[model samples]
Target: MKNTIVVAGATGNLGHSICTELIKAGTHVKAIVRDSSDPLKVDALKKIGVEIIEVTQFKEKELTPICQGASCVVSAVTGLHDVIVNAQLELLHAAIAAGVPRFIPSDFSSEFTNIPEGENRNFDLRKEFGQHLEKSSIKATTIFNGCFADILRYNTPLFNVKGQTVAYYDDKAYWKIDFTTMDDTAAFTAKAALDATTPRYLRIASFRVSPNDLVALSEQYKDKRFKLVDMGSMEGFSAYNKIQRAQDSAGEDELYPKWQQAQYLYSMFLVHHEALDNDRYLDLMWSKVEDNI
Candidate 1:
């Protein structure tokens, strides 16, 4: 439709992909960046003819004008949730002021609004923020697309061959949860933002996979079986303690980035070992991954 779209945090993994998707959809895309000095990613966006908006600091006064006449804003800014929340609040205020039609907050982790523990202090910040958007008369869509499958390679030592074996909730036990590829998540989010009927909470699963299934997939790729490492409740807490100690020794400045710490302390915020039975929502699962492994 050639609607003007602004993608905040366009340099991040999800942001980059979302911006790319918007461009591919023939939307006039604006890549908003926090750092002008990082030209590599900026250059990539420029190659695709995406307009660039670099801000040394986030200011509502500055962005409000930029968002004027825009159709939608897809926020893929990952990292600390608090900083993201604050920045998104600024974005929402600006979008409302600018009369932007729709605002999609970066709710990529899970359907936090549906989870019992998600409504509380530990995990409901983003959920509540979505509510705030509705109260303000903005059409906002929240997508819950489970964990980034790629994060498993980076976050868990279990998948890193050079590190300790992949650990799970209990040794050799599997937890069923939804997983979506980064590209799929980006594409689906863009689709949701543009779809007029898109609900406030958009739940999706490109694939319903479990830790056990992933282990099998990895073994298939490597042609070897790795031993399963177990991290029980106590062990999980021990790992958390170790992470906390590391963060403490490094100093408050280096401590858990708000999002990572939030994920650690309140993992219930994510797509856990529960199955999603929402049939009203389309599954939109990509067939490539199904045949890949």
Candidate 2:
């Protein structure tokens, strides 16, 4: 049998893209899914010649044999806490037990290690998972590809393209934020998984854009002016941090706290702008912001 690559969370947006790219490259892909997954997605995977396996949980004993003959395992699970911490951890142990050489965790966001704790719960969970991976024997590679470009295009509360408006906490419009389309990120991930010599950490940016860049692109694409609103200064971010800390202590389940944490994250994007690693992968083709716009 050919060496197969197992993909956990294969039904997800990122995982599905990665599986498609791998198949395009003529690699055998085993898509690990749950029984509760959508039937349409499972049928689609089957139609594309992907072997689908259903696992109720990421238990090492059950997954080790399932992962037999697999060369690599790529996880694309997305969520706040449990999915990152519990599910991925179990998957890591399973990979190790199956003697898989390479494992890529679901870390397709901003550089979580660069951000401080208590500011972003999602980043914090990823950071904690990275620490766990470091202590384990599993050889892992983490991909930080900045914000999802699709989010900028469609997630209205985050980027509001249709309204032609952007809300930022900072007063300036000169902070460079990284954005990568899901397809591009998935392609890079698939290539990285196939290459045994790939580095442990990769930072990829499809394109870097600021509020000014967004406004310029919107103007050019829609032939209309965009309105920019500054929510407040860094002081507002500080207040949000304080509130988020309080919410953590109280163990409250309020959406406002998450929104507050998001403000702090926006501030991090402004303060800690990292250089891109897109040029490192010379063969990979990246999407342009103009096309996405």
Candidate 3:
């Protein structure tokens, strides 16, 4: 375990990808999972040479031993309050207790650090956990990789390739939104995990495209003219998003509700990672927007 990396949420899409990348680099990885995790996924990780550790609870005493001597512990788990804030807190303390020097929290999204609090619920939870992570004696690194590029295929209004349209608001037709493919994020993360001197925060994006750029890319890839639709002003859009959040109290019970998606979209417009750390990992094969389209 001294030279090995431990990954929480190893069964997740990003987590699995990270493990594969680390294995490719000849890094020993320990995949942490709950006793209730799917066996098939655990088998998949084992097949790839990842050492699996099953735990009943994410408590410090429980996980500290599993984390002992790990060069880094990566948290790829995603969820609401209980998981994001509470679960990660337990894992963080455990990693520290185990003497892990570096920690990579599951803060993989828009660079909400620049954005004020209360804009996004999931981000709010991340910020809450970040405050705790800050006080810990361990060094931490957070990757803010805008939105995942795979969402483009989901036919959202922002980058609807199937509908051949890219929508914008507040005359932000040219505002670039950051996006990183899950594979690319995983690749960089794997590299970072192996390197113990990584800084506190690293920003990455596979491709940053504005609405107009997306339209052009979509048209070229799909062989169809993509339309650019200006939805409204930023002020109006902000008001509308706030209204949706207020009206949809039921969304609080649901993970990734419509309003939460709206908040992500709004954050996309609001924040941009101007200085990216892509150069930090030169061996990485970054993905382009067209590659995903």
Pick by TM-score: which candidate is best?
3
In model 3, how many backbone clashes occur? 0
Better of 1 and 3 by lDDT: 3
Candidate number with the higher lDDT (1 or 2): 2
lDDT of 3 at 288: 82
Q: Which regions of candidate 1 deviate over 4 angstroms?
A: 35-37, 114-128, 155-160, 170-172, 234-270, 273-293
Cα deviation of 9, candidate 1, in Å:
1.2
TM-score of each: 0.78, 0.89, 0.97
Quote model 2's TM-score: 0.89
Off by over 4 Å in 2: 155-158, 241-273
Q: What order do you get sorting by lDDT, best first?
A: 3, 2, 1
Higher-TM-score candidate among 1 and 2?
Answer: 2
| Tens-place lDDT digits, model 1, residues 168-191 | 664334655666788888888767
lDDT (tens digit, per residue) of candidate 2 on 1-293: 55589999898878988999889888899998888999999888888888999988767776788777788999998765677888888888888888898899998777777666756666777888998899988778888888777767663533567787866666557777787899999999988888787677888888887777777777888788678767677667666666766757543343235554465356445454366667766888999988876
Give me candidate 3's TM-score against the actual structure.
0.97
Off by over 4 Å in 3: none
